[model samples]
Target: MRFWMVFAWLSSALLLAVAQETVLTDDALHKPITVWQRLASLAEVLDDIRKQTGVPLRCQDALREMKLAVYVQNRPAREILEQVASLFGLRWRRDDDGSYVLYLPDETRRALERAQRDDRAATERALREMLRIAREWLRLPPEARAEAMAPFAQTREYPANMPYSAYLMEEAAAQRQMTQEQRVKALVADYLSGYSPQGEPSKPKRDAFFSEEDTQGSLLHCLSEAGDAIVNRLLEGHTLGFSTRPTPDALPLPPRVLLPFWMRHAQLSDESVLQFDAASGQFTEVQPLPNPDWGGYWVRLSAWGNSLEYMVVALRVYELDGKTQKFLNKVDYQLHLPHQEYLAETETWRQWEAWATPMEDWTARLKERTPLERPKPTVNNERPLLAADALEWLAWHTGYPVISDASRYVPAWYRDSLDSPRALLTLLSNDLWLRFDPNGYLLARHKRFWTLNQFEIPERIVRPLEAKWLAWQWLSLDDYATLAAAITDEQARGFTRVRRRGSIQFWTAFDNDPLYYELPALRFWASLSAAQRQRALAGEWIPESALTLPQRKLFRAALYREFPPPEQLLRDLPDDYEVGLYVPSVFRSEGVPESRSEALKQSPDAPAFRVLQQNPVSELSVLKYKDELGRRTYTLHEVKTQVSREGVDWKKVFQEAGYEGEPAEAILKTVLDTILQFALPPRMFEQYILNQSRYADFGRHAAP
Candidate 1:
């Protein structure tokens, strides 16, 4: 009220001032300045302007203190002031009393308003998505809603009818304090104006909408006009209000992620995603993003206590697409830590463990009873555990190396839910023939490994619906000899070798891959004498048809190749050095990968890029690609490295981050929430089908 009163008083004074303007005729503002200062403070120059023009300047002390350089050789006082104000990031308006008032620029004042508008638009888009979900929920039977909305809400209850207009009406009555007639007008006005935000597909000036504006009795006209005075956007003539008709009837469903959404504390809604990955610090992706044209989402979260300033999890959401996971959008969210209350974790990176819900109430009774005196793990509250994780937890307690892809290698434990860890271990040893190698690595000859395939480990999750004991077991020569200790070395070696178990082996075998000069091409080059080299360059070896014109020229110019190698290129280097050679696996650049096999996906050794040897860890080698006839060829460079590892000041890191020790799981969840994949319950959605027309819209792969 006080603000309005002050505004009205100023407005009245402006009217009275205008009445006096006719006689006063403030012509000094239009007058030119006399001097040009190279560097002048606003306070000094503006005062000079006031003195010369006899026009008083009204501005804040901060604005007055702003200094700028100007070359204003006899310019109007008003023009000078305008240029000065612009340079200082300020704006000026003529006051009612014929004085100039300096204020902030337009965007600076409306920054918060623009952010709010964006947030509102994102929320509206997500709400439209929910309304569609509600329609689908209504279509589903009562029994199905629970399952369908399990990713979204805790409850199955929802309005039977459309809720958009009802919400608008509620906003009108409760917030707007609109009368019944105005409320009806709002709905009626929406119907007449078609739903297009840009107001494209203009109505054909019909009787139902004779003109663009319903100017005869407009309620929002004054409001929009008032807003226009502040920001020019509200008065846009092209505002196609939303459609009164319902959202589209048919909808494709979202992909079911491999996340464990069923949790004790965290709840993932259909619109809101909360992912958790504590195992691998690196982010993992879940495939098949939603189809296009579905609106994206924006979320605002409340504080999880006084939040710890942490890292931002950048989520790169792509189209649930096989066509290169077409880059769609990105969202970043802070990780939350709610460890005080019984914290929950996202089953996003769940292990395929068997009935492995931690027996939180468990004591060291098993350790007390058994001979294996391994470390006793901290007992936690009992909750559901993924099968793969259960096996790993038991392994952690017993100090066992986790079997690679244990979920696929040992498929039985997923179904066989044992109550105790001993029962699980007992099941493994007695039924699956579990045994460790001399070095403590799990042996590969177990029944579990043989169940899938005898020649190779099957590259798939071989989940048999029913347990089939020794289903694929067969007697191999090794297996047969294992049952008979009397079997001689000759019998064990496929019955070919004589009984020479005590004989000393005279063979020395070594791999030549790391030996730089041992390449076959180099050997061929060395085998050639000078005359042979001359003949070879003259096309004696490698027919002219096989050699391109450029290749022949290169061979002639390069003297057919150097035999026994040239002098050292690194002769300038110091002699005191540590060097050796190690070769890592070379992988094809997947270029976002077409599709990876299950074996390759689960194999740790087959990373897209990895250093097999750690001591000489360096990416200093260059991969040189050569064009050849019907084959890819490369010359590899090898180097060995030895470097001391640097120690990190983790205490300083935690201190700088405002943490006493390790932060809560909520913090991790906050980071994961940024990623939208919510696959849980060990259920996966339909995989993305690679088709001929995958990138039809992207113009990469043309339509089939």
Candidate 2:
């Protein structure tokens, strides 16, 4: 039997991502911390604190392995933390969101040193393994070796017009001539030659892994592994039968093992089976093995559900010798199916089911002459809208599911008269590149913009709240209910209970949204005059009170309360998913573009600002092109009308509508546009306009 045959029988395991529970109490920070403990590893203490506080701590793996002893009297966590840092000659800094990060002296230097050492060790181990495998393979009989290599020897052809087709064809023939043993030796020599062949003898040589290989040569090199071979078949523009099982070994048995395991242990006779050809991905009728005792196998393959990347395959093993046959075993395996091959094997409906529409179909749809509805957008006071969120909502209304994978959190607010699918799609294309595949799915790639990054987080979020800050405890039942609704989706209604110890200040946002919104609120407070700041600190400032009665109600109900206290809210909410503000920035900050942009740039450590500031080419649609002297020039297509076409100054609108403070102008503008154009509830505009102070007392006795 081939070594790979036994390799298939080996079992493997995967590690799952599980949240580590941490128990943190106010006592840890407020009460005296008394520690007269034995020797312990610094990592162990940090890990315990992490579990308790639910704050993640990251450090060098080397430092984690180091041990330390500490014995201290009653002290606060901060002081103890300082003392521990001093003990290790390390320093720590708290992030904008109050999370502490520890770093060692010359940490970068040490890290690089360790990485280099590890790489050298890894290379040596790989070299040894390759030498061992080469020796074993060389010992095998030539005929057995050739048989082992036969399956992978099949030539893969390219289209006649494709570039480098001849080169690939010639390379494939050379690969097919080499026996499996020779191939393995060549691969090993190829790898070892890198360390000492061209470079100095003292140091291992470094070079490209497959520098001499063209497309076909690369494919042959990769076929050392079964999974790679299957994937390569798909890459070669060929359909494949994916099987997950150990069939009869395709390679001939070793001369030493002349007596087969099946021959020694006769099981049963012939049974029904399926066969799959290696050369042409075709299935054949079941037939008895010429000599089952010599060990033959059968395979069957089928589509694996909705996955566009993998397929299911089953293999049945059988044995036959001298007029008798028996069944050995049956196994199943998953084969890697490339998207191209999957598309080739699938039908129109099947492809459309997974939100994958081909590019050609999208082009056709874009050019189709269909009647388009001109629907006016109305403002809705009940909910705040995010661009990605609005896109999904609109898609849902139009019978399409949009997958949200945007990098920035953009709130959209625009009024539009065009309700045609084409117009709506054109509008969305401005903010994100929507890749619609034949498989009924859409992927959203956001336009580049300077949003928030982890480092640019406001001080309020990173540090403990000041004495005047209001906590989640002050929120009402509706507020908590609304917040819970925002965090949930169709699948997860959210955790049944939120347990907070004292005034928990942990940050929940694992993305840039918080930085864009919450950070502005803190900056807004900082922007106020001393007198105004003092008044705000004295609790006289009522930002939400300035909003319309209905808007105010929704505003007060939109609190960030991911961690509720010991008491739980048992109130019932509408089963329909709620669309409301999850971040309080809408109510906290006055929209000011300059201040927002400045605040974003304040954090030199934030790479996101650079990303956001750049005008990246989000999407490109070519409408027309001309080729002149081999230099191709193309005309880019642009969407004529988008959410920004309304061009409404959101800051002025919010203020004139009696909102007290400035919202995050940048984010607010985006959200308002998205909502007005896509997420706004029908007929809500009248109520919204009536409530606006600017429109007060308008047509009191008019049509009801």
Candidate 3:
């Protein structure tokens, strides 16, 4: 794995070296500048502009003689260009290749006319193709073709430089084009209006619709307005496509009707999500103002304790129309520690484990009880009887070297037998008061040492999940000094908070900073050659701390991958390192419990479990297309099924997102069927006679 990673990095570097040379002029243009300067003619001023702002400016040859003299303070490249255009009675526009060009009034007008002519020509070509396809395939007469095309006949042009697939879709189906046009408008209106298809007002929007708390309405309302402002700015009057719809449905709904939706959805219907009675936290239900047209969501949270610090939150999201009650997914998150009662229960568990017979004692007792000769381990025979022994045992088994801030200690007498490797590790940790991290290390410290620095969050808990596990283990810090001590520089020390992009009321951390802090180090480390990394890890070159924090982290990670701890590498290795060969597997004398039900016992066919066992589909084919803004995305193009009783008879085509991750293949098949149920073309939907003599009509496949 390390070898391949280095190769990939070298390959990428080689590709970058061979790619097109950067244009010096283009780079100079977008660079920002602050300067105090004077300009002469437009040409000279443009030169000055380029020199100061690094913005390449080109003046029309016809306007080369135009003069402009002005003193300017610090201003951006764009602002300088605007001022120049205004002074010379000229205008500037970006070319298709992104270069900026200036033009006089008459020249600009003529350019616009030419663009319009070109647009009309493109539209006429598409229309001709559409008519020809309709005539050949749909058997549409001239009159019928005109009638079918009437809705899109009003000087409608496609987005400039359209992809071939979009052009094909436009020429193939009039209905699809009409539906897409309507869908985009509907999505925009639903996002802005906060109402469902059934004309029900969204709950969150109504509740915070007029909030004065952040001087912005509720969080959802603020978000909606921010999004609207951006869209409005981008939405200039266009000659292509249909004119914008100015209907009542597109307007924002009044507060009175909307407030009730928020009131209704805000109530917690799931007792599991709420009703957690804890001394530190109270349950709060938050209904996200529904975007009825786009989707809607609600969140339930338990915020307990003083200042409502500890929390457990559950979120539910709706897909399609909310009125239909179709939901996409739900997720639960833990953000803080459990209350006192939970901690007390855990203490009780530890005490009970201390009373149970330790595994070493049990094995010793078994040997004494039997007189027969027992098999002995071929490699290391000694068990992990001490703290150092346990560390060596872990190093050999987990394949990563262990680093410790721990001292050697006498073995504990109360280690209980556990079933799995993880369970055994947990027992050792609880019984011995030690910390084992799979990132490749173990720490043994006194009880007080663990309690003193509680704020340090483990890398695992810092993940998308509540980082709650770290909180539970550590007590809350009352002041900044204590908080600072708990956090290592390797851990995230701070977050730069920013208001949610479209909303003024809600706030979110700057995502890129945290991502940068974590990703760059790992990525750079993965890109290095293994030999170089080995040298660094072995201390053959610079000291570990000499490098930056990211580099240190990555270097340690690579070392953990290839080398075991120093103690374990010595000759005449300790017996505990090979203890795995000495350990014996024991089965319960009472025999394994039967958990399967009668139905499963009889046929071994529990429907849900059977679906999981079957690999229904593995690969999903997709088509990549660009939206109006030229952003590319992959959508489902086809779904092929494995052979079953259906004999692999069905093949479906649709444009929608496909499932990923751990969902069962059956669920994916269902989702594909749903999309195709709505997307199949009209002609393709009808039953066809496969064998006329036998009168066998093959209908479309049954709905999943």
**What are the lDDT scores of the predictions, listed in order?**
0.28, 0.30, 0.29
RMSD for each model, in Å, please?
A: 39.8, 31.7, 35.1
lDDT of 2 by residue, 1-704 (tens): 43442233221100000100021223344445443222234566666555644566545555563433233334455445544553233556555666566666574345335433443333333333343543344344545544443443434455544433234334545755775445545554443221111111211111111122111121122222233344334333333321111122232222222111122223323213334454553333232222222221111111211111211111123244554322223121221212222222222212123222333465564453432132322344222333544454344334433333222234443224124455445545445445553333344433321111111222222222211112211221122222333332211111111111111112222212222222212222223345543443342423433334543333322222211110111122112211222211222223212221233333233111110111111111221343332333433222221123234454454444444654321111111110000011211000000000001111121111
lDDT tens per residue, model 3, 331-365: 11111111221222233233323323354443332
TM-score of 3: 0.17
lDDT of 1 at 81: 61
lDDT of the structure predicted as candidate 2: 0.30
Residue 470, candidate 2: alpha-carbon lDDT: 22
For each candidate in turn, the TM-score is 0.17, 0.19, 0.17
After superposition of all CA atoms, the RMSD between model 2 and the true structure is 31.7
Off by more than 4 A, model 3: 1-176, 179-183, 189-223, 227-524, 527-704
Return the TM-score for candidate 1, rounded to 2 decimals.
0.17
lDDT-based ranking, best first?
A: 2, 3, 1
Top candidate when judged by TM-score against the true structure: 2
Point out where model 2 deviates above 4 Å: 1-379, 382-384, 406-409, 449-704
lDDT of 1: 0.28
Rank all candidate structures by their TM-score, best first, as comma-separated numbers.
2, 3, 1
Q: lDDT tens string, model 1, 1-704?
A: 54554455335434533433343346787898743332234556667778989887757764453332333335566655644443233556667887766666554335324433433343333323323333344344544644554432212233534343333334333523544333333332332232111112222222221122221111122122222221122112111111111123211112211111111111112222322354432121222122122221111111111111111111122333353231212111221212111111111101111112233322332354331243333322111222233444445444433332222223222223333556555434322333332233221122222112211211111112101112322222122112222222222221111111111111101111111111222222333345544554342323323344553443332221111111121122222221111112232122222212321332233111111111112111122342322223333322222111232243443344444763221110000000001011111111111110000011121111
